[model samples]
Target: MDHLACFTPGDLQSARAPDLSSYHWRLLAQGDSWFSNATAKLNAHANLLQELVLKEKACVVNCAGTGEALAHMVDLESAPDFVRLLSSPEAPVWDGVLLSVGGNDLIAAAQTPAHTADGKEVPLHLRLLRRQTEWGPPSAGVARYFSEPGWATYADYLRSNVRHLLTLRDQGPSAAKPVFMHCYAVPMPRPAGSEDGGLGSSGPWLYPALKAYALPGADWAAISRLMVFHLAQLLKAMAADKAQFPGLHVFDSTAVPLALATPGSSGNSGDWHNEIHLNHSGSFKIARAWSEHIQNVLAPPAPVGKQR
Candidate 1:
């Protein structure tokens, strides 16, 4: 199972492939750390793009960066490379566009401190998790720990930015081409952080926030699962409304059965490399499932009688 050949925008632009015709599909990808390596400790060689295996050979030009928020990625002024490659006069007609976003945005919102560094209380709309005193009735399950107003704001932000991205695509050479995205697997709120000898470290994003809000350790996993479910549902809604996003396609990567991490482990456990990102094995599982879905969409099976 060979992976697709992926290159950065600079690499592709400086040295255009001598034979673009050789590849079955030419893809343009952009998003967050999932499409690029976020932490060195979590299998430096493994990211979504690197792990993706298509039935037909494809050359992927990736513009995604590590730790980039969805807001930043869609900002034309901040990230010009994506726009330049997709809409410029010299832009190629991409077969499809791959995206791995929304996760970072969710993480950013979830990790917001209840109080600011200056000792000011952050507004409810600015915080995803509610403090112990702010929790709703006990019957609400994981919903009790979250602020509805904040979740609503987060949902709206995701919808609008995705719309902006699609609108941008419509303005480019790849208009009406399939744009694929995927949902994330639920994560455990543990003490795990992606740091190996301090080369660079990140995460345990949910744990700190949960602890700050005085959430019980027993409910951490359910709370995390609920948040991911909400995010997944939002993406599904966007994909279903063809009027808003004509070529948008989202596959549920959460359907893949990766092992769950232990409740309090600080290092690699199950399929997770750290608190947020998947390890090599887990990424491979997701990439393979997502690749199958992409293949079914782009190249459906031939009719029973049409076989040669």
Candidate 2:
């Protein structure tokens, strides 16, 4: 297989051929709010995947949602029933399984209310304490004000979710077919405070990328590394459990050395949009990572001809 180096999300979808529209592959996509942008892109990619795989009848099923939503994918409403669902495979459980999860779990777990010194509430301060992030990069969230210990808890949740997904992958798939996923993207950070006294305006839209506060007491640098650690751990676990999941396909989209290593905050910048949702370019950036990973998993070198 030759190497594929550069691409944006648009290039991925736009590059498809008319003949590429017929492949059908069963797919399920899910992620927290951070992945909302990528979800659409992944669906488009799935269409492409389906088209390519169509010589052998298949279709993609997009299961995009928040972590809160993912818990329910297996009917979490009934914990016991959900457990049963995990224990058994139902219809359309064949072919391929594409996932984008864990981000929502991080977001969901990170959400907590802030309190005053006397246990009273401060609206502005509470917002900070809650870490009420709106996606983009962690550029504008309340990371700075957060203490080292609290951030560590958030890190635990991130790692736990990845482990959980791997267990599911090993159990559900027939052990032969590939289960693919990417390392969720990290939000670009802004200078500690960039809004009305550091937090800027709580605008519905993120025009000027937010620059949040960097509190002295918090563990700023280490926080970002934690996400990568979880991703690495996930990959390592999968790699080590060779027999458990023989063909687990994963791509390290966690850090972009090729593009947007330094995400900009003005005029659409480079890759990020708002902090979480990626622009077409950003999505493609990830898609490019995905494409190469898929190429290796499905084929060392994908032929121009249809993939059955």
Candidate 3:
């Protein structure tokens, strides 16, 4: 991966080392833990950006950080560095932008406790999942655990923020250049917290949220899968609607066949470093598939007269 050079916002802005023109592709990356977690120094625990091996030499100026939500990422006040590097006069002409957001936002929303108009508290109706007592019979599948109105509100919020992000990109030097995003793979509900060699630990997000709603342990995986599926559909819809999100490309990372983590694990299991983040093997698989997809998209169209 020597062909790939990654820099923090400060390093890229101040030094601008490794002349930008040297790379075949110059990209800007912004997102959450997937893009910027430094819990472990080993390559095995490197974030998505560090694991990427593109078809051509590429340099990425990363403005992402751990625990950043989509709303914060899109906010000018919260993301001044990202804003400046993207749209300012001194901004670079990036070949593309890579984004890894919405995951944290979803988690936060799921964990939100329901509140009454009178400011009273309610435990049965969480922001995303309804309590088991409110669920339909087991035959209802994953649909039984979900709150329709809650999901609708969340969907609207996600779409609106994504549109805001697109607007920001259009205002930048990289206007109309491809902006690539991914639908995250489904993770099993577990007690796995990302103990990244003790740098800092966080998560088991969905696990606790579901527990608070008294969801059955056996149904955790199915519930999580359905949630991820819906998210993927939303992203696909945005990509298809060129009128709204032109040049937006979404990689259906969920389609990648990676091993699943065992339920109830407190540490690394299968390909997962924890509950939400992927370990080296899993990340590599996803990165390779995504890289190939991007390469195909960037390839020039065949000449009209040429046919096999």
Candidate 4:
């Protein structure tokens, strides 16, 4: 397990509100339609809460995921509209807010493919397509990845959406509570004849220190680095906006970040499916990491003592 998983929800027991288990956790997972994933994690997290219920405890309730949650926000609408969608004081007041939005935004930025309502073929970003592994630098092909019809609009949308979410995080009574924000999907191996973009697809770009991504022949190590790159952008953005949102505290999900996805590595962080979402083991690991993140926030920083 990654060191991040070592954390446990210690003092959050006290932070529990009345019937918190019944409290709603409005999860907003954008990009590539990852609702099932959001719901699944919500279920897994809910199980933990269910156990707490017997102890007369409670946790956040969960909303549906994918575009359903964020549809209103990203609906080719105005920025204020997005803000209104997010910060509105609605029923089942949200306690914990989890987001996985930017992956789609980046995908849009990358100008990837689009299928018609009837599943007809549409143009996909040629930059992403690979006839060989030795493909290099930005080019007409690369333009598809870095540029698109809605690229500029999508980038603007992302910036605004992020700002709105942060503002909302500081709005409600549960403002100071936990906000579990997931980063964008890392590029990984995309199975041939499949476009789920879950795991195992290599990334769009790979720079040495700044970032890295899986390649055609990449081992696990390379894949893991890409995952971190995707995730890091979100974390870094949140940290940058800290001053704007004092009530919020961002979790470095990429903390103790995966070195690489080599088989039998100390941390099995990345290496599974390459894209954004994790596999069974990976999801649990992330859930555990989130639990720990919540624990860290509710409690004082622990002393890093030598464990006997």
The top-ranked prediction according to lDDT is: 1
Instruction: Give stretches of model 2 more than 4 Å off.
Output: 1-25, 34-59, 65-90, 107-176, 191-239, 243-247, 258-267, 300-308
**In model 4, which regions exceed 4 Å deviation?**
1-56, 65-95, 111-156, 169-171, 175-178, 184-187, 192-231, 255-276, 301-308
Instruction: TM-score each candidate.
Output: 0.92, 0.52, 0.89, 0.50
Kindly list the per-residue Cα lDDT of model 2 for residues 206-259, writing each as its tens digit.
Answer: 112122322322343244445444545665566456565455666676665423
Pick by lDDT: 1 or 4, better one: 1
Tens-place lDDT per residue, model 3, 43-152, is: 43567777677667888888775433223335457667788887776698988888988777777767776556786765542377776567877788878888777778
| Model 1 weakest 10-residue run by lDDT | 65-74
List candidate 1 stretches off by more than 4 Å: 15-18, 37-42, 65-75, 197-201, 303-308
Residues 163-257, model 4: lDDT tens digits: 66666656644455555554532434332111233322323222221122223343333433443464466456655675754444555555533
lDDT of each: 0.81, 0.42, 0.77, 0.39
Query: What lDDT, from 0 to 1, does candidate 4 have?
Result: 0.39
Give candidate 2's whole-model lDDT.
0.42
- Clashes within 3 Å, all models in order: 0, 26, 0, 21
Candidate 1, 1-308: lDDT as tens digits:
45788877777657554356688988988876677644453354268888788788888888874433323335567567888887776788889999888887888888888899999999999878998889899999889998878899898888888888888778888888899999999999999876654433366688998888889888999999988989999899999999987889999977899999988999878988888878888888888999888887778888999978
